[model samples]
Target: MSRRQLPSEIRKIEVLNRKTGKKVTRYELRMDAGVNQNTGQRQQVKRRYATDREARKALGEIAGGSTDGTFVGRSALTVERACAEFLAGSHSIEPTTRAAYEHALQPLRDRHGDMPVQALSKSDLDRLVNDLVVGTSPGHRRKWVANSINPMLNLISRVLADLVAQGKLTRDGAALVKRLKRSDKELQTFSEADVRKLLKHVENNRLGHAWHLAFSGMRRGEISGLLWSDVDLEDGTVTIRHNRVSVGGQVHNKDPKTETSARTLPLTPALKSALRRAENTQKVERMKLGPDYGPGEHVVVDEAGRPYHPDTLSDFWRELCVAAKVKRIRLH
Candidate 1:
């Protein structure tokens, strides 16, 4: 006698009746979910779909996911969970970029962290962007949307793409989130008189040398990260090598953002004088602090000779602007 042949292991769609024997509007898909690791027994999973085509597509995806070990049931994933997974697995991201992503994504996480990834429709994403734009001030709405909301949406979209690649999501929801057209705004700057007033006001301040470099077009981080080794008082030049950055309130020294950013900058007469004054002043501070002083090679430092936190310089600049009665501009 011939051996009995088994049927193909393909999922099937079934039409079911309600408890009252009335026909339901949707179709049900049932399939074996493979053997359970703990129980060593076959498990089953079921899904409901609005149409035969939907059922077939989902069934095909489920079968493929099982074979590839990428299967993630719809009920088992959320936006927050997906984000966490993505962040945890993204080992190649730089520290500064990762920190920016974390900060930018916080609002989205607070709003839709628990929403299911598969359930986030285009309308939902549109509503999120609209709500964020409405909540911002009229004068700053464009900036806030462009810098914060748009970046957050892009990051979420990246996470969704990772989920799709892993078979957790059928498509990226962020693809539907439209980017806003950003118009160019006039750059804010201080007048020559205001600049002179600001410089004069900071002449006696602890960050006097930093203010001089700031006016010379050196970025805040580059100024903060300066070392005596990187400065040539005789040549009146400052080399842009390292940059000190603040992320989540912590300070770190990293290389300049670009190769062009590492070029040498000529110092003005006032900057040369300021650097000399700072050098003399730090000598006195080192004498007073003795072993407690930790200036190392950094040119810009606090009273204790420790390097200044990058963000603290901005705060000081704001206060100095107020004192000088000048229009406050960003420290960068």
Candidate 2:
């Protein structure tokens, strides 16, 4: 049978079959962004109808600027645009997470700047992430590289999801994002006994305060911003509501890493007593600072009574661990 020549404005609608990995047509008419909203987030939309008369009727609605009835094809979105939107929507993300997402996109953005939304196949993205996973070794990179790669893969998938939400992509970037695996050299969490022993060993170490906080599951930033005002001394409750994070090279106060992360934990007797001693020590140091005591709000501060960089606290943690006879495993 011969095919009839279609009008110039209408076009075919395409969808990718995730299982079979092929683009198949729905045999419908589609229009570009017009005066109305259509399919996902375009200024245009695809109006599918049983006949030319119905298609023309739908087109009239689109032309007249009413998105009353139109189907959006999911392939007409771009990855770069999606990434931008994703980051914008994620302003609430912790600084660490935001930084990680930007770092994850560095490779792809450098490579696929011109990739069209409709042209990005699942395999294409999967290959990019998979290449990162299998290309490096612990000998050259850090041992937990796969762990880093997996989180970045998840971030990329999230970016693609925003595209899907905006009706830009049907594949949803799942194929590529799911293949990123955890590295074999991921951190081995210390046993409870190890945590206790580490705490006991660091009883006299500078990290004694930090050890108490980490063992209690307070994130480094939360503990760093721990204030004397939030401690319930008589009740022995440590209320965690503040966090100090560094973003774009400057430190700022932000929400806790997650909702569950900002919680009140009951201080064990050990913790309570340790906190008292630490407070006494801090007061002595502050007194010696003479005229230099700066309000005395932050519970964890340097000798100068100023908040230390959260990252520097971690370095001291490693040093304390080594001094406390804790084992350091090197995957490299």
Candidate 3:
């Protein structure tokens, strides 16, 4: 409503979780010096500290910066605006990664899309998480509801970290949210049998090509944008070099999910034979088209030697997974 001023508003600390007896000290940080980029209404920040010392430390951080250091006091911004900035910046990242963040943020936007940046609190975040697990939304997808909670917390962590780096908020805000842990029941990874059945189904009926690579731990885009140059036929080793991700409708190449993901995996004999057959089939089709043959060196091509979209390939993998067991090993 009205413009709020500097010297930073006071913080209130109370029980955040009555059941767990968890508590937090929160501060409504004000902007004494910095200017708001959008509304020109001066800058303000909302922060939560685990303790009084943490709160004071955050204050010193904001006060220490001359609108330029590790912290800044900015106001006149809304949660939606900050979210937009965060999402826009994530375009440089891989699509699957960006999608993960978006999945986490979706429920938050649906619930708290209207709250201003100056008024958000740790409790507000706690509520978003609580509602995600226990709240009911009629006709909503159950899987979406269940999986949406934790990553939203992670996204909040990332968003606050960015604000801290830019001097808008302090690290405490990020730190405060990261402590909200999901229950043991919330996490379910694929079982070894699940993996084996899924993989067998994929291999026998429709391996989806990329499906084989991802189950083998290849990053989605790595398998999507893979080229023959990155693979060694003689050695049967696939060296990952790049990934293609679509961010906001633009397909761009980026690095693998992690540096470690850019690795070499020996092709199984079955996989090698499959590839050989697939190539033989493609060579004949290319002849039928004669001059229409696309560029060579692209693996996992369709009947016409055309490369497949990684996203579509992902969906196909999901369906086939439902029908088949994925291969997995147990470690002692």
Best candidate per lDDT, number?
A: 1
What local distance difference test score does each model get? 0.79, 0.68, 0.63
Q: List the residue pairs that clash in candidate 2.
A: 32-44, 33-43, 33-44, 39-72, 77-117, 126-176
Which residue runs of candidate 1 sit more than 4 Å off their true CA positions? 1-26, 31-45, 49-75, 136-143
Worst 10-residue lDDT window for candidate 3 reads 323-332
Instruction: Give the residue spans of candidate 2 off by over 4 A.
Output: 1-82, 89-94, 136-187, 191-197, 328-332
Model 3 TM-score relative to the real fold: 0.60
If both were scored by lDDT, which would come out higher, candidate 1 or candidate 2?
A: 1
Compose the digit string of candidate 3's lDDT tens values, residues 105-223.
77666666787655678887776655555655322335333345556676777777776566555453434754444446743467777766665665644334555566666766677
Residues 53-154, candidate 1, lDDT per residue (tens digit)? 677677787788667655655455777887777888989876888898776666667777898778878887787677777875322344355767778788
Prediction-by-prediction clash tally: 0, 6, 20
Worst 10 contiguous positions by lDDT, candidate 1: 3-12
Give the Cα-based TM-score of candidate 2 against the true structure: 0.65
Of 2 and 3, the candidate ranking higher by TM-score: 2
TM-score of every candidate: 0.80, 0.65, 0.60
